[model samples]
Target chain A: MRDFDLLQPQHLSDALDALAQNDSAIRPLAGGTDMLVDIRAQRAKPDVLVSLQNISELRGITRENGTLKIGAATTIAEFLKHPELTKHDALRYAAYVFANPMIRNSATIGGNIGSASPAGDMLPPLLALDAHIELVSKNEARVMPLSDFFLGPRKTAKRANELITSIQLPVISYQSPVSSLQSPVSSAFYKLGLRQADAISLISVAVWIQRDGEKIRDVRIALGAVAPRPMRAIRAEEILRGEIFNEMNLKESARIASEECSPIDDLRASANYRRRMIAVYVRRMLEQAWSKTQ
Target chain B: MQKKTILFSLNGEPREWSVYPNELLLNVLREQEFLTGTKYGCGIGECGACTVHINGEPILSCLTLAIACEGKEILTIEGLAREGKLDPVQIAFLDQTAFQCGFCTPDMILMTRALLNEIPNPTEEQVRDYLRGNLCRCTGYASIMRAALDASVLNAHRSVQSNEE
Candidate 1:
């Protein structure tokens, strides 16, 4: 940890002003779980750290106009504790397995996204939820889809002067009547880590499906650690969306998802292994989500 | 970088310390406050060796900055005992011989206390899941698991005794 100036802003506007300093080295410090480690390893050397911990405006979960708005500073522990979030199983499951209890107690949703790691546990679920990120700077504020936010590993579309304010997720009801199966949205998340807890994902998958009668109304398949960034399998999604819900279509969708991701051989797993697991997990998640819809 | 004084309550004592922006809470506690019970096993957040309770939640101190501790209530392993008596978790660890090397004991005990605080009597799976971050190379986790369960029972007994009295 090299010496750096610390700016503790009690207000979001103050924090934004601090970041608005034109200096690219001025970085917003959320949960230090990732940033501090990077700093200790000398991977990230920001000249100034604008602490967002004190900003009350960027810390909570709220629902407005059918959107689940999660403040960027909301910790993983907070995410799990929120009663309303339990319905979002894919996001909740991801939060449950996000490192160990201690790390989760401190790690923030925004920090996870801010790190923009390919293997970030929260990425796949957020992508599957079709989350929109709200970024605020001194001059202006903007919202963008989570898919377009990530440019590469540790890289994002967020400007140097901006701070991520909140993540907005569309609320979909998963508990519609089983008889009619009217607009019941179901989702599932799966992560193949080295160990049960405190392990980074070797490959992760999240599936979100909305059923309309006997057909798939809308569907999203997001894969992590199998690409340059957490990405949606659009080609695979196309195969299942608006199509009749069946085993054959699910298998084809899974196969296409495996083909769409360009995973590289890493220390944890080989590219071949990741590609195969993507197909397997995608299929499993699809099956799990479909069953939930019933 | 300019050093700033932060005021916070540590182990039931309110103290002020001037620290650099880059100073981690772990280093500040050990060096500035002389509360070395919070061990520094891994500088990263992976290992829970530097675990401490801020506002009653266990978090890795290694990854937390000292300045962030301002106006927050911090509880370290040294704060667990009261009136010269060890905490229930500490007593259970001693009875169970939960540690062989004792390097990870402080954090393990802290985590168990925090766990029991949340779930009065947690199941074996829950205990393992909750304390997974606090890695112990010794004892193979069996004794630690026993200690966590025993601590829950001890806590129950203590509460009962207090209720009766």
Candidate 2:
């Protein structure tokens, strides 16, 4: 890696100041699992690195008002250990299959989102959860839906001078008017990689659903590694939102999801294969999530 | 970039070292500190040859900047043994002949120690999952698995003996 000045900031405001410097080459250093690899490969070169490792503000997981507030610097290992995450299968499963134990110890949630890779393991699950990211600058702070954050592969809506502070996931609950009936809300994630560990996804899917009797009260499906960015199957979700949860509708929604994605032929997998697997995994994930609601 | 002095605990020893901003912890340990047991296989963090414990958790040293070690406790393979006696995990690896090329042994041992620390009696599936990142290119995983199980028993025996004492 090329030599660069390292600025270790103890406070979030100081880190923001360092990033808001006149030079656009200044980059915020989070876990360094992704950025360091990119730098060694010459894919990213920054003249200055603002280390956020010492910032206590960006390292925690908390819940308030039925929303999970995850500090941007929280590592994947932390997610695996957190008690609250176990209730959300999609996010926890994504955390479970993310790289390996060694990488998870150092890879932070913010870095995963900041890198903005289409195959990032956390993106599809977060999209399914309807996560909102909080970005902070020296002068201002803003919140935006994760769906609007990614523009393309390794691209995001974050400004050069801003830093992602935390990710907020709303704790969605479904209630039945009749006390005797049961309402279930569940989410599931699946990743197809070449190997069991440390392999990037060929295609991945996440599904979140609320079951109201025989009909789907609400649903969201997210796909990864099959587009320029991790994306939602909006049309397929629209079809299933109020429809009966049945095999025919599930197959139709999965087919629509496969058609919605625009994947390219990559070294790991062909575009045709990815589209086919997308249909299979989408259907499987939807089934898995729906089964949990039962 | 100017060189900066960092203070951290290495192998239970307090040390201060000067490093450039971009210098990786793997290089500093191998070159400056002369603790070369940590091998460099894939500098991109894919290979676990450079694994070390930062604050008791195993992490990739090649991808970690040396400056980041300031005020942190780092445990490398050189630190795994106490006073020239091998750790239980190390003894198990030697007894089981867990490696062939031995290029990935240091990281494998470190990761095994970390896993055993977390799960004293981990199942075979758990052991495989935990050590999945530490790849043995010689494909000597069967022996490695045996060594991990043996180490768990050895660790338990040692703990029981120490408790009796």
Candidate 3:
């Protein structure tokens, strides 16, 4: 890694001040799992590294106003251990199979989302949950929908001096108790990686469905690694919304999900292979989601 | 470049060191502190050869910045044995012949210690999951898995025995 000035801020405000002072020349360091790897591989280099480990405001999970707020610096281990996240199968599955135990202990959700990788395990499920990010800077703070946060591969809408403070996700039925007349959330996430452990996803799918008995009232399907950025399969979702889970709808939605993606051929998988796997995985995830509703 | 000297507890001893911002904890342990038990398998975080305990959690030292070690307690493989007595995991590994080349032993032992510290009795799947990050090309994972299970029982026995002392 290239040598750079290290700024250790004792507070979140101080960290923001350091970022504002250094602008694009500085990068915020959270768990350093992704950032350190990028720096070592020479994929990223900055004049200063601002450490956020000491920032208390950026470190825990909370629920307020019917939303789940996860601090940007909360490690993947911490998030997975949270009682709320564990009960949500989609999030738990993603957390369980993400990277490995050691990496999970050191990688943060904020860094995962902040890195803006299409293959990020946490993004698709979070996107399926309709999560939004909270970005803070010295001057102002703003919240952006998670779907709109990513601009491209390794790119985001966040400004240079901005620090991601928290990720707020809607408290869906899966995260709360099922009340009378309230349709329980049925969600599932599937990742197609080369190997079971320590492999990046070639293609991944997540589905969030709220069914009124056998009819799907609402559904959100999110796909990852099949696009430059993780995206919702809007066309596929539209076909399944207000429709019953059947062989025909499942096949059509799966086809639409595959067709709507924009994947590229990489060493891990060919673009054609990813598209096919996307269809298969989408069908599988939808089946899993439907089974949960029963 | 801005440099800072930070104080942190290492293996139960307080130490102060001046380090560069980009210096990784793996390099600092091996070079500055001369603690080479933490191996460097891959410079990136993929390989867990540099696994160490930071505040009772297993993390990749290669990915952790040395300057970030301020005020935190770090435990390396060298810290496992105390007063010439081997850790239970080490004893179990020896009895079960868990390693062959021994290249990944330090990381394996430390990872098991961390696991047993949290879960005294782990299921086979849990043991495999926790040790998955520490790759051992020599043992084929069978003996390692056996050793991990035995270590849990050995550790539990040792704990009960110690509590009575």
Using all chains and alpha carbons, the TM-scores for the candidates as numbered come to 0.97, 0.97, 0.96
TM-score of 3: 0.96
Residue B77 of model 1 has an lDDT of: 93
Candidate 2 lDDT, A1-294, residue by residue in tens: 798899998999899888876466999999999999888888888999999999999988898998899999999998788897777899999999999898898899999999999999999999999999999998899999999999999999999999999999998555656652454888999999998888999999999998878899999999999999999999889889999999999999999999999999989999999999999999999999998775
State the displacement of the C-alpha of residue A212, model 3, in Å, after optimal TM-score superposition. 0.8
Tens digit of lDDT per residue, candidate 2, span B1-165? 999999999999999999999999999999998998899998988889999999999999998999999999999999999989899999999999999989999999999999999999999999999998888999999999999999999999889988999
Categorize the docking of model 2: high
Off by over 4 Å in 3: A172-183
lDDT digits (tens) for residues B98-162 of candidate 1:
88988899999999999999999899999998998888887559999899999999999988987
**Fnat of every candidate, listed in order:** 0.96, 0.92, 0.84
Q: Please give the DockQ score of every candidate, comma-separated.
A: 0.89, 0.88, 0.81
Cα lDDT for residue B141, model 3?
87
Relative to the true structure, how large is the alpha-carbon lDDT of every model?
Answer: 0.91, 0.93, 0.88
TM-score of predicted chain B versus true chain B for each candidate = 0.96, 0.97, 0.97
Output the worst ten-in-a-row residue range by lDDT, candidate 1 chain A: A174-183
Q: Which candidate should be chosen as best, given DockQ against the real structure?
A: 1
Tens digits of per-residue lDDT, candidate 3, B2-51, equal 67899999999999989888888999999988999899998777778999
Off by over 4 Å in 1: A173-183
| Rank list by lDDT | 2, 1, 3
Better of 1 and 2 by lDDT: 2
